[model samples]
Target: MARPSEGAARGKPRKIVLVTGGGGGIGRAAAQALGTGGRHVVITDIDASAACETRRLVTASGGTADIVEANLEIAEETANVVEHAAAKGMLAGVVHCAAVFPQRTFARATITDFDQVMGLNFRAAFLLAKAAVPVMEVKGGALVLLTSGAVRLEGADTPFQRPFALYGASKAALDRWALGVAPELRDRGIALHTLTPGAFVETPGTRRIDRRAIPSLPIVPARQVGEAIAWLARNPRMSLAGRRLDATAFGHTWGPG
Candidate 1:
């Protein structure tokens, strides 16, 4: 593993935080935020090049990171990434940003589309949490789940919401799954939380969609989500545990430690 630039470890060893989808967008920002906090961030993405770019940014910012390429769709690949991170010194937390939002309407979506959606959004979170629980149980850590406000508004069939049947269902499952597991993990000192950035984030995927087709909801910068992930990892407020949090409500209040 390549060594990271210098920071204050305070005579203690640096903790390691694993970030999925660290290649770009919020994941990249989260990894950098962890690095700034003096943790060794393990940035993983299916795209090796994108993960590498995140590593580059982390290193340039005087933070440390290790880049690993793993396509989370494959169970073995997901295990590979988690196991590799577990082997690192300490498993501080996981920022799971590896998700895809396909634009298939309910009428047009296929079984295969549903499978891919559930597999990536919910199944991967389950598997990653399973693999990390044992290692994190040793020292107590955070597992951050990126959720959706869509779950909050799925009952409403407004124009900006109709196209979300598949994606919303998948994320809703994730939100519930994470909450279901949060209490169990809390017994072991790991805080599992489901959070939404509150609006449509302009990622490579969202950029392809017709902006006019999306809802005119409150928007937040990708980095805010990133900072929120880092804050969630570094903060130990159990009051926020097992809850669905909106970024606008909780994110801006915390600063990097």
Candidate 2:
């Protein structure tokens, strides 16, 4: 399969994009927006039903997308996703949005829980970058990873005093991962951007939490979070590589408000 750079031969609109965790929230939003932008988006998720539902939403909205079911927590599945996309020819973009946040206190948290969170959040970022570099190397492309505000506001002095050490630590790892990949991406004609959505969203998991316990709760809507992701995915600015965008900053730049 030819990479975008080799196939484009010149600057042109990107035609194909692959988004992990595209079945829900920001990933779905990015897929939908990119599809509306006239790109063929491939949507993959651990949840088969969610992937199908997202694909349905895209098709209904006059966008194009394909659903692929894969558990990103597994290394082999992660590699397969990239390989599958590469074989399709000229993969112009990749969005890594799949994540697992196992919130538990240090004493109560098992190594299995921590490892699972790390595996899904940080390890997947590393592996996906490795797998996609080849396809993106031939042509310049954008890479976006979803971090969390948990990392940024986890300190004791923050407004929210949640026991999210595990989640924060993993996200901090993601920050480092994005920075570590920036130079390599520069050499290979790719850009990496990290999007950090602050606070619990109205998603099913978050709705289970006490609304008051989450400070600055709903400061930014999930759809707005999705739009910020869409911007980072589509924007051609190289300066954004290795940089992290918080909810407020991204919202001010690309929100309905």
Best by lDDT: 1
Clashing pairs in 2: 5-139
**Candidate 1 clashing pairs, residues 3+ apart or interchain:** none
Error of 2 at 110 (Å): 0.6
Distance from true location, Cα of 6 in model 1, Å: 9.7
For model 2, residues 108-215, the per-residue Cα lDDT tens digits are: 889898888888888988888888878777867788888887776526444344556777788888898788878778767787888877655566555554446545
User: lDDT for model 1, on a 0 to 1 scale?
Assistant: 0.79
Model 1 Cα lDDT, one tens digit per residue, 67-143: 88888888998988888887776787887888877777778999999898888888999989988888888878889
In TM-score terms, which candidate is top? 1
RMSD of 1: 2.6
TM-score of candidate 1 versus the correct structure, residues matched by position? 0.91
Q: What is the TM-score of each candidate against the true structure?
A: 0.91, 0.86
